[model samples]
Target: MDASDGHADREWRLIREEAWPGPMNMALDEIAAETAAAGGPRTLRVYRWEPRTLSLGYHQDPDTVDWDHCEREGVGVTRRPTGGGGIYHDSHGDVSYTIVAPADELPGDLVESYHELCAPILDAFERMGVPARFAETERPARHQPACYLRELHPAHDVVVETDGEERKVSGNAQHRRTDAVVQHGSLTYAVNAERHLAVFADASVTPAAFRERVTGIADHADVSRSEAVGALEAALADWADATEGSWTGDELERARDRASEKYASDEWTRRRPGRR
Candidate 1:
């Protein structure tokens, strides 16, 4: 992949941000997608959640979350642009990554793009000596309120088999606009699985029941957050013609503006943004 024969060195930047509020993270991801759509270089962004947050799917019912519980627990609240069950990220405990690229760099279809985009995560797990594979079976229709409690969908996440059972280690979701795709996922270093279920009042998601289905890297192996990030960084840079760069002033401003105007706003988070 040199700069010739239509295989030019595709310039992309890798950003490692300190833990940020959920709104900021969502804003930055949207900015990345806008940049890519407007013919900018691809961007790979990684960071952790500060003020630990629970993010709902863009169209997920806000009523699904226990507002009283969230307020009492002092957890942050926001909604992702992608659709899926709500996700709970422990404060400074999960390694989250987002990739924003032009459609040309990804498979046009959503399902295919999930597998293609998730390869780096699978690669990272493998580099850490973890035998992770995609769960190739379609998900059964169960109305679970949290992703960890929901059944695994084919290639929706990276999982490892243990104790004759498969447990998910990472989960990803994507949002695509005209000519850009933004995919984000979390590789959990550790988590209090029982605590996460508290945000949702789903009767079926009990600690003793769903905890067995929820496992992270720390649960199965000695992998550290830095190790996972490093492996993913190498895989991503190799997968694309990424160059080391930082966010420009304009980019940061736009992200902040987006955060305040959309992600952090009641109109967006309280309900489906622009949903008919």
Candidate 2:
């Protein structure tokens, strides 16, 4: 976790995980939230994967994906606690953010909360020289197979211009627990359009058909990942009273245990709704 502005006393913790499986990532966020409620600090975790993975949304069906394709390709798969759709995180194109904060710290309404968290991403795009905006209209139902595909009520859903045409640069989702809110999302830097198309063949638009609908910093703005990260830090700073901090060993242990027991369990992953 890199601190850009040096505001080092506002109860913020930065965690940069070295690419674990999908379940571990979700587990860490859950643990971080619980620990924060128990006097742990507000946290921002930025991470990537060694082997790429697919994360399905909480209400999404594992059967919706071509699991055999993923298995044959050795792609790691796990379900998110948040609602939306599925996302394929390949190494080159995606950057994931998990922001954990006390419920009181977030906006009261769900849409407002989404806008508040996504402020930094919008700022980052502008800093990179891309004029980005959030779509004010209601999100289309046709874009629901993936989070990026759908522009819901409050997502930042970074929109950028190309030859006067608008498209999406990034997308995100949120999960609210009693004490905390977890907002997780990905910024598309470069997309494997074909792979996404293959995964969501039943969707209205195939990745190949809507390649033009997506935008990325590499495609439009001349910026490095480090620059994007700097912009993100600045954007987050605008909304947060940040501080420098780390987790205790016990916290990590608890997160690991939860990852194994809850996030990694097939009963949790494959369970059907209303069908105990």
Candidate 3:
């Protein structure tokens, strides 16, 4: 894909798809990244899961999550290529976004890349009149286990102050492939903290120990779903020309095939033995 002016062509494609299973969603993102690299289009997708699901980080141990509990609770479990802790996704609490672009379209380094990608989220929150800023520190506090638990540098994260209390509202993760970079994250509007605690509370994780490590947007920013989406749209519009659309037949088919072959396999999901 050549931009006449030596800059990436500012094209944004937005997709809203019906709730899909975990592997399928991951596959679609991989496919989108490849498509974008081919100069097809820079794409953003918003999707959900039919049944609630738990997604673990690429290198995270599946055992870290209580699979017995998830299975009993009817929540599906899948792994993501990105590095981060696990996340629980429910209908009302979750909003996920995926950005697919050529490397040149982003920053020169990983840290800078995160900032460029995360700007829209910060802008969105600001548009909502929320005073959000990125955390300046790179070191994690003693008890912080997940990315969201501690603020890291260069990540386009959302931090806000309400009632004189500071908190984080959103966090993101990225996966850089040979062809392009795919960054995806969730803006947690609400969280079932108790449910998450219940699932994590076990011999491995104590309820009191993990409670201080997780948070949601509802904890700081008081905005409705429509408001949040609108803010995001406005913010994204400032950076690129967003075109609302759906996945093409070819893209969907490729994603489906990849999901079955790679994302659904235990070899890929449980790559490390004696871990899960």
Candidate 4:
């Protein structure tokens, strides 16, 4: 289906406002993808991280993580199934989302697929009165270890122009398998630079530098985190023509099992993608 089509022509399941630990969040997304691949309903969900969390990209170097700092600060750590640099998801400072459907149902080209899936994200920003769009040009990386600070690409990076410069507000990536695709991302509603930086092993990235490279919904719009979440949830639902929904008991059980086996396991988190 064309992503720009009105809700009258499409259907999806909407899961909103759930909060879970990092490992469970990742597992749930995986389960959602599996469900879609198995002829189940497509999903659009917005969720939060409890205790905040630092999520490493699928291929991100484990050595770039500051394990001691994360433990000391009570920040949970997990690895995403998608690829990108690390992202620090704050409990109240960020919003997270996932979209899952059969791979054949979306665009065939990778970048085009991102554009199609990210339509609701741009609409969400519009609903919150933030003028955000996909970046039109590439920007050099300010820091390679962080998703927001890495090189900006027009493919999936969302930005708002401020003071004549485009500052990143969101980063998204996709994990495509033979039968399905799962697209997930983090959008900043507020910045916690100190905590964000402390998750990385690099100590040279100052908060001022981070502020220059990244931005949040609160930066350009006077919207609270709760307000932002509401707008985003509404946007995703409208975009997908989705109905209010919840996980089935079996799905939740499967996600819990997957979390224990993969996301929460040291063998899965500490090694590179294929190693585990």
Candidate 5:
């Protein structure tokens, strides 16, 4: 069940877990890359946040958020190891995914690598009867504090065509290590653009305008989390040699340590690290 089985079969170990808090979720994703780099199974993990939370990018300033709104809603906030804009993880409306693989298994070009990892996700959307496609043109950077508020990354988004317009459905970020690559993204079942917009400081986009830029899978199909995961598994199976798997006790312990010592730590989350 390990990648050391020679490159004869590109076996992807899939791990699916229930909703967890922001710190644990982010820590486990880091562990996914570490797991692969050490010659363990390359993994794909899918999970969500409990009680919901707002996850900021590695370099983002927490002070930029409208903390007043976050406190009122009882939402926890933490930072992601990956770089990107902040995202609102709604337990009821979002499903998140993490992909870990040997760097050799992905494209050397970062942009092309985004396309490579996104293929199975696009297939998963298609299986749900949504005709999702990659953004054909480059999107001008938004520099907005929030993720859904930003324009699509020409290479990173999964968009669905609607009435002659292409609306993005997901936002992703990846990190390349010496021997492995880790990418994490979120797919929404519904869009609560208003609630998401409230947390960002001085966001000019209104709720009505925000609705025009993003779409959810529920727009095209209604499937439970398990069903959506099954679709992803089917799609990944088509892309690489894959198998279902579980996490070990040590991975759990390491992840907890990472969460408490890094992700949930004020010093780590508050200050930006150099180059990931």
Candidate 6:
């Protein structure tokens, strides 16, 4: 790997942006990792949720969710393969992406891998005129139920300064296996404070508090959602020196089956792994 150029020894694929329901989105990420481990091209995918979705962290307690609120608001719920806190993904307000490659292709150390994979995301934010960077210091957790409100780490948490305070703009997490790794994250393109808070069981976290803690790209930059997503897609493609690609019909069918069998099931989404 050369530092001066984006090209590397391994081939890469950029699966152009697509939209799917929450369950399908999670299933596809799992499929991507599996394929990459089995000698498929290293993949970078950008996608959107068809409807608003609440994605809970792998280990997050299901008790923290307000099921009725999510139902009344027409919000779909699913659990991510990566661990963190819950995220209320607004269809138009959140830009999500995933990177999948063989474990040996990325750095063996966790922090180093995050920095390498997230470099393009930082570049994308700069392209949007948002001035985003990893948090310089860790912040105390203000809430336990949401990803943005959790304590910030310099490893992968991205922040932007607004009103002289560094507020979070994106959150990234990874799920590693023996053969491959999947890193995915959410960039807050715009904030829907009311709807974001409504999905959680905690009423103490007010909309104003949520706004103060999290900032979006649209908060400081005058870019539309499409432009923001475009910047990310271009940055990611250049980062991996990737060629344009799309899902095979077989991949889509497998993902659909996984979605129905796993992500969409209450048994998987509601139960904490390894616990009754």
Error of 3 at 161 (Å): 3.1
TM-score of the candidate numbered 4? 0.96
Residue 89 in candidate 5, Cα distance off native in Å: 0.7
lDDT of 2 at 125: 74
Question: lDDT for model 4, on a 0 to 1 scale?
Answer: 0.90
Model 2 lDDT at residue 190: 72
Tens digits of per-residue lDDT for model 1 on 1-276? 344522136668878645788999999888888888888878987788888889988778887888888889888889998888888886545788898888777777778889877877887787888788887655553446687667887757777787877777788988888788899988777767667878886656557666566667777667777877788787776666577767778989998999899988878877843573
Global fold similarity of model 2 (TM-score): 0.86
**Model with the higher lDDT, candidate 2 or 3:** 2
| RMSD versus native structure for model 2 | 3.6
Model 4 C-alpha lDDT per residue in residues 1-276, reported as the tens digit of each score = 355663335558999889999999999999998888888888999999997889999988889999999999899999998888999997888899999988888888999899989999999999999999999879999889899999999999999988988899999999998898999999999988887898999979999999998999998898888999999999998888889999999999999999999998888788764664
Ranking by TM-score: 6, 4, 1, 5, 2, 3
lDDT of each: 0.78, 0.71, 0.69, 0.90, 0.79, 0.90
| Candidate 6 local lDDT, residue 171 | 97
Between candidates 1 and 6, the TM-score winner: 6
Lowest summed lDDT across 10 adjacent residues in model 6 is found at: 1-10
Instruction: Give TM-scores for every candidate, taking all chains together and pairing residue i with residue i.
Output: 0.91, 0.86, 0.85, 0.96, 0.90, 0.96
Model 4: runs farther than 4 Å from truth?
Answer: 1-10, 273-276
* lDDT of residue 205 for candidate 2: 75
Error of 5 at 224 (Å): 3.8
TM value for model 3: 0.85
- Residue 209, model 3, lDDT: 40
The digit string of per-residue lDDT tens for model 3 on 82-184 reads 8876667777777777888887677768887888788777777777766677765453642232444444443665556545534556778899987789998
Clashes of 1: 0
Q: List clash counts for every candidate, in order.
A: 0, 0, 0, 0, 0, 0
Tens digits of per-residue lDDT, candidate 2, 1-276, equal 144433334487666434667777888888888876776688877667546777877887666677677778887777788877778887767777788888876788987888767776777677778787876555465456676666544345667767765667777788899898888878877767777655653655766546666777788778877677666666565545554456678877887898789877877666554333
